[model samples]
Target chain A: MPTTLRDEAAIAGIGQTPYSKNSGVSELALACQAVRGAIADAGIEPREVDGLVTFLMDSSDEVEVARSVGLGDLSLLSRVAYGGGAAVPIVQQAAMAVATGVCRHVVVYRALNGRSGQRMGQGVSGDIITSDLIHWSWYMPFGMLTPASWVAMAATRYMHEYGDCADALAQVAVVTRNHAQNNPAAAFYGKPLSLEEYYNSRWICEPLRLFDCCQETDGGCALLITSPERARDLQQRPAVIRGVSQASFDGQEQMTSFYRPDMHRLPEMERAGETAYAQSGLGPADMDAAILYDAFTPEVLMQLEAFGFCGPGEGADFVRDGALAAGGRLPTNTHGGLLSEAYIHGVNGVAEAVRLIRGVSHNQPERCEHVLVSSGVGVPTGALILGRDNG
Target chain B: MLTPEQKQDLETQIRAFVGRPTGPPSVGRDLVNEPMIRQWCDAIGDANPVYLDPEAAARSVHGGIVAPPMMLQAWILEGWSMHRGHGEPRDEQQRLHKILTDAGYTGVLGTDTEQTFTRYLRPGDQVSAETVIADISEEKATGVGVGYFITTRTTFCDAKGIELGTMNFRVLKFIPKEAPQSAAANADAADAQPQKPTRIKPPLSHDNAWWWRAVAEGTLLPLQRCAQCQKLRHPPRPMCDDCGATQWDHIAASGRGALHSYTVIHHPRFPGYEFPILAALVDLPEGCRIVSNVVDCEPGALRIGMALQAFIHEDEDGFKLPLFRPAEPA
Candidate 1:
């Protein structure tokens, strides 16, 4: 298959606010701060940005963010939905816009007061009535209300099918927290978690302990995308967007995709990963590191299988062999991921991918050339292949 | 901790009650009927047509209206009067409560419940239930207080004595820690004020109102059948995706299914719910799936592809909901 958008656009800059339980500011302010930081990092004027993309769930609008950041007229403005699943696709949208000349300079950002404000873990409130809630009613009556519970259904099935146990999921928390110990920005920076502690932690949902859930964090993250030709003239080495793709399969529901044929496998991620690899002409072997989404620890394992980092039902074995640690075959979520780092959706993972490609990550891998960044699992998801611009 | 003699005495006392009938088998005051079904449907906001629409019911696979399976317990609750200990303590439950109360464990709170249904109860069916003491746990420390978890198993049947369903309900009987007078007064004052309602019911909408109605009418596992292509879909929709047909009807699903996936929820406790609640995604024989609470089995015992049958679980507020349980071996 021919590569469609390979190396056509590059992530010229990455920026983020210090993630925390409470940012103590408006989401609009957070969006502006991250966008301004991205513009500054890319050595580009705010007025030069001609495109913007964000999640539909984000409070800040494109026009509002543009006004706040002093950007001029925009040529492309788009929003992706499905929560964290929108992370990589917004970048893919920006890269596509830039590559096709729909926009010259594009900025993708996500900002929310997820912790102090609306906690996603609180589940759905009654005031909002939508088609989605109508679908959720089928399960809500049974007390399967939260995202953790929603994903737990699949995670439990995965364990039952593979003969795996909670130990497999606990390893993810241990590994990510270990990485967080060295990163000051991580919420768990000072608190290292042990396997014993993981076992002792109370269950948020069975097969998923408290440690398996991501932090409810308040923060923002943004990325600057531009043509590869324009990136070479910028201040930093660009992480070329070698490939990007978004995908979803038939019978897909938001999180309660219980009707699908296979409960253990995330077909959407597999489709997105396959498309990204085909577009980049770089398979999993080419990736020196990965920044898989860790909204929940089990998702990271599932993504490992979906993205072909390991064979199907081999995720626990892969993690058990230390393949996700610093010196392992594929060091993942070196910044501790959402499990230990603050949850800024998966955009923070994207910033980490850029840092890896730029060779500036705090937990810098020995050889950082290509990094695979995945969006949300158990939803219509996306993936990105970012590579260092060696030339 | 109890002395060895006290432990033995307590064990013998608790063990003697095991396998004894908690109460004489009693029938509901009213046989299953449409008016009660309508009220239930309205209360729970289920709008499935097979429960409410005679025309729709005739065309569906069930061929007639059926009661929501979860109402098995509600049909034979013995009402609030019996529950408040208004009369003589004739039942084993009252005897057990008296035993616990005399021992200084006065407080009571329900801990968990599990139910399994053998078949749907239809209108005009006379329902009855028999209760028995299943287990009595030794004293355990809990966030509320030191308590014993008493589990009761109730078996429901029809007028012909054919088993319809079974429910296992557990409650924590505890001794409250002494409270300071001022704190107790404040708590009383707080309780005196009308508490803000914490229980959130499912948001009812136009497209799925029929589904809730069917649930109210006592139909188990109702799914929309596309009029054009005959495809069965759940989480009901306005139009059929397969044929793009706007016109559709519903079918009362076979309560039989398998545990496709499941989770045990333990955090951010919601009102009107028990902790460590087993939530499951059951794959119906019709090739669709529905999410419901899996009861009557240990959380550890839940496995993929385990056969399950539907049950109607009624909450403390008397709201009925569809649930599931592991199927008994043939």
Candidate 2:
């Protein structure tokens, strides 16, 4: 039988560049800066790092990043695809490398000038020949080109089946922005979103208003991973990787999985969540807080239900009355998530989870020992469980 | 603003046409045949073998070649020459248009349409259509100007009087909010402004060029069938993701579908598209879905699972794109 990877590795340090719409520098510079900061935070020499991992969509090459960070040699370097869904899996890969003794210290990072350089929300164009582009050609001719539009199709059907409306979605934005107010690193730090503001925001796609979408951010986030034994000697307290998983269902197709029978649910997420819980021997009831991916508000609602945080079709009810706020049942996305914080393809959420596990988060929960963090929703997704050393 | 008496008169004139047949029954110019079917398949880029290769179609449940169900209206559409009020005006639609035009509501635009298909059309079948006035709205302020909404329902049948489908089409006839500029002013404005670039067309590749050709030929809705698995698919691809079949064929759509889900785009307006664009994912009865624009209905009025029909919208570039509109009551 295969052994669970629970508690095998630990996240020793987390570092991030200030979230901004435009970094005014190359992605490589931002990547190097974040990697150097993470190594420094880990109290490990740059040459000590042996493994590096990131998303396949990331512009910076591993060798370039390694060279800039003054790393001598690397043994394992891997890239995961499916965009933000690679977040937790990247860390999982690093942890596996450490647990298996393939590499002593591994660094995982994601860097993008999403707003300053390549805006993803802008509809696809150019001469791209790939199977994915062929799939997109079906909808693009009808102007259903953007990510928001693709998700809206599923969201509308979800609303129809669940008796939920935009009000429930608005609550998510309000809660996320409210948390952003207290976190100085958040993009919308001082400006909190009101329910009225969320409702009044212009529609980017029907059923999804402007405020429901994540801000395209130009920044970088990096995390350092090593065996729990090594992390014990690091500068900061370690956030043990209790469990991690990546999931994709049989019928999954990027963002347009509309053909599935139950349009409202994220089956892939349910699988990932199940794997994480089984590996960690922890359920939703054991979690102190969570950072559900908030690329769009509807996704947060769907994730809440899919991860067994709530009963099916009751995600809207689960999020009511500041329940996800700082003092509520599960303080979700206490750093405001991608909605109000920087969207470093969800790497920032992982860093925030580490902060919560270390009890150093600005919006720290009262009893945050076991924190759950998720990657992108509406696609192949990933999740992680992080706990303090005592836990 | 109109006087009370004029308002009453206009309302009475518009209301009188209610419940009246809109036009005389019209027959198609040509019988359904293989060439027309092939031409339509080429135009719409459908490669459903059931529409082209008889031998492969014979093995399918459909038994033989059947016209796409969505082609019900297209079969009976009067060609371009007769589209702009040709022949003697006898129907209530003509009289209503005349009244609106005389009253300075000369500007007209199609708003929406709904369609329902009862059966697939076959080659050698002769189709005919008869229309009736459904409703006319009260004068209301709109983005373009003050206008009244006019709706009509058309029923399609074959030469033997067998019902095939029905279409509910609506349009807005209104006076422009801004007065028309003089010809010289228009010319000067045109000269002053750098020539606006043409709207971006869909990128055509080997896999999708046939669909664009169909659009140019005005056959807007088409479906693809995997030659190996015989499964229907859309957003045309060269291979079947299901059975891994590289061989495929095309079929015309029934043009009758329902709004599965939709989104009204309101940000980062792209050129050639109007604002608040209603993009929809339509579920076809043929067991496939398509993403297209839902036209002629208010964004607020759009609903998931609402019945819709297909219509061919001609862009400024003369590319006929398939769009959907809300279905009318039976």
Per-residue lDDT, model 2, residue B296, is: 87
Q: What CAPRI grade goes to candidate 2?
A: acceptable
Say which candidate scores most in TM-score.
1
lDDT of candidate 1 over A259-304, digit per residue (tens): 7778899999999999999998899999999999998889988989
Residue A145 displacement (Å), model 1: 1.2
Q: What tens-digit string does per-residue lDDT give for candidate 1 at B176-200?
A: 5433235432322212222222334
TM-score of each: 0.73, 0.72
Q: Which ten residues in a row have the lowest lDDT in candidate 1 chain B?
A: B188-197
Deviation in angstroms for A125 in model 2? 1.6
Error of 2 at B99 (Å): 57
Candidate 2 matches the true fold with a TM-score of: 0.72
Tell me the TM-score of chain B in each candidate. Answer: 0.53, 0.54
True-vs-predicted CA distance for residue A280, candidate 2, Å:
1.5
Candidate 2 structure quality by residue, lDDT tens digits, A106-217: 9999999999898888867667777777667767667777888888888988898998668888889998998999999999999977777788888898788999888899
